[model samples]
Target: MSAVLELVEFDAEGFMNDAKAWTPEIGEAIAATLGITLTNRHWVVINFARKEFTEKGEAPSLRRITKTTDVDTKEIYQLFPGGPAKVAAKIAGLSKPTGCI
Candidate 1:
């Protein structure tokens, strides 16, 4: 199967139709993918992910995101196709980019 197809099939919570509406379950899925503990302290990941999509017009790389957050890049890529960027973008309600997604 294609990488994107496989990514879509992975056990993430819901589809990326609306990340802003993501529930705790969705957040947990994103956090699990990034190998991070999702406590109240890390809520910024969701907000940052949203900001990244709005500002950069693209998902932030795992490296770039981890530099700003506590999530790990290696663990993120292991779970998601394009790593933290993709997962973060999805959770942030951003549309999947053409080639990247």
Candidate 2:
């Protein structure tokens, strides 16, 4: 059976305060709020961001994402349009990037 996750409230930057509350459905909702449609390509980045956060206890940096993931910086920027790391991370249900304001 699939788990049902409710729509969560996001912080000002659109990040969910509780990572455990996140789900694929919630990710889609968050993406919609940012005027984004979650494509397969977008999922690659989102999944990567979640993995990084799980292993590192912080959001993944764009640099690390590009270097480690199959996608490059150009593709990621095009996928997310504006604020790729910040936006994608938020949609991935992670906190704001450490250095972002």
Candidate 3:
């Protein structure tokens, strides 16, 4: 957490405007706010998502997550509750993924 960037600055959806400032501690804090505990399964999805965003400049879709990361949509939903892509991205400390409501 930076001296300046407060978690409240993030959107209602919990995405920060300056995603580059994201850190694992921030991610954990965001997840706690969202009522999600970071599990190893959750970490796998988050890591895959961040990697996809870095390589493709876009967050991977639910279908993409299933197709590429070998994580099925059902498991994703279980891991993220609410909206998987959006919640997961916020917890991953990335920008709100495109095409996610």
Candidate 4:
């Protein structure tokens, strides 16, 4: 975990325990820990994920992310690599999405 993450409360899986603890800088730190560099495209997904979590009380699924955002499945995979929705939710300081393992 990054120094920034150390300052906040995270679950065993590195998801933030309190979504309010998140900041843009914290998101960057989380991405760095995952070996990702935030791009404009990344921010689009991150923002959408956070907004969805705030309004809906759960992380958005990969399908929802693809449909609502400009990013598609392939691009999301290219951007987030391992598990697009999972990684994006983590960086956005949200719990794992419903369908993610």
Candidate 5:
């Protein structure tokens, strides 16, 4: 299976329980910061981004993410330094990147 797919298979409870890493609080923070309610769509994007990062060891670009999520690229870039990939990665509980992933 693809690395992305594999990453998607990660245990959500374990991820949320990691105090030093992905946590439920962090997810809540991201949702509030983004001014968006956490829904199935958000989960899909988060999981997809995590999968993409795991498969490539890097985040997907804004363009690709926009196409996948149908969210505005400019809006995402305004919210995240690099773009949706960066924001999505964070929401997915991935470490921040030094630059555009």
Candidate 6:
């Protein structure tokens, strides 16, 4: 785990315990664990996920992301690799997205 991870609390699946406690630094640290380096494009998705979480009180699904953001399904898969919505939500410091299996 990174130093930032050590300072925060997460669930067994590694989602942050509190979205309110999330910071950009912490998001980067979480992404590091998944071997992801946040790019501007990645931030687009992350920021959108955070916004969705704030608005809906839950992380958005992949379909929702693709439908709402400029990013498409293929690019989201390319960017996030293993389960776009789930990974993006984790990095965004939100709970595991509903309906993600």
Per candidate, the number of residue pairs that clash is 1, 0, 0, 0, 0, 0
True-vs-predicted CA distance for residue 67, candidate 4, Å: 0.7
Put down candidate 3 lDDT per residue, 1-100, tens digits, no spaces.
4443464467765577666677777777778777788888898998988888888877777777878786788999999998888888777667777874
Q: How displaced is residue 70 in candidate 6, in Å? A: 0.4
lDDT of 1 by residue, 9-83 (tens): 332543365544555565566556556556543455666666776787665666667788766666455444454
Query: Residue by residue across 11-67, what tens digits does model 4's lDDT show?
Result: 899788988879999999999988999999999999999999999999999999999
Worst 10 residues of 1 by lDDT: 1-10
Instruction: Extract clashing residue pairs from model 2.
Output: none
lDDT (C-alpha, whole model) for all candidates: 0.55, 0.83, 0.77, 0.92, 0.56, 0.93
Q: Which candidate number has the best lDDT? A: 6
Among the numbered candidates, top TM-score falls to 6
**Candidate 3 TM-score over all chains jointly:** 0.83
Q: Judged by lDDT relative to the true structure, which candidate is superior, 1 or 6?
A: 6
**Each prediction's TM-score versus the true structure:** 0.45, 0.87, 0.83, 0.94, 0.50, 0.95
Error of 2 at 82 (Å): 1.0
Backbone clashes counted, model 1: 1
User: Which runs of model 1 end up more than 4 angstroms from their true locations?
Assistant: 1-38, 74-82, 97-101
List runs of model 4 lying over 4 Å from the truth.
none
User: TM-score order of candidates, best first?
Assistant: 6, 4, 2, 3, 5, 1
Off by over 4 Å in 6: none
Instruction: Kindly indicate the candidate among 2 and 3 with the higher TM-score.
Output: 2
- Give the worst 10-residue stretch by lDDT in candidate 6: 92-101
| Model 5, runs deviating above 4 Å | 1-20, 23-26, 33-35, 69-83, 97-101
Candidate 2: stretches off by over 4 Å: 1-7, 99-101
For residues 1-101, write the lDDT of model 5, one tens digit per residue: 32222323224422322223555456656555556556665676666666776777655666767787766666565545444565666566665533552
**Poorest lDDT segment (10 consecutive residues) of candidate 5:** 10-19
Stretches of candidate 3 above 4 Å error? 1-8
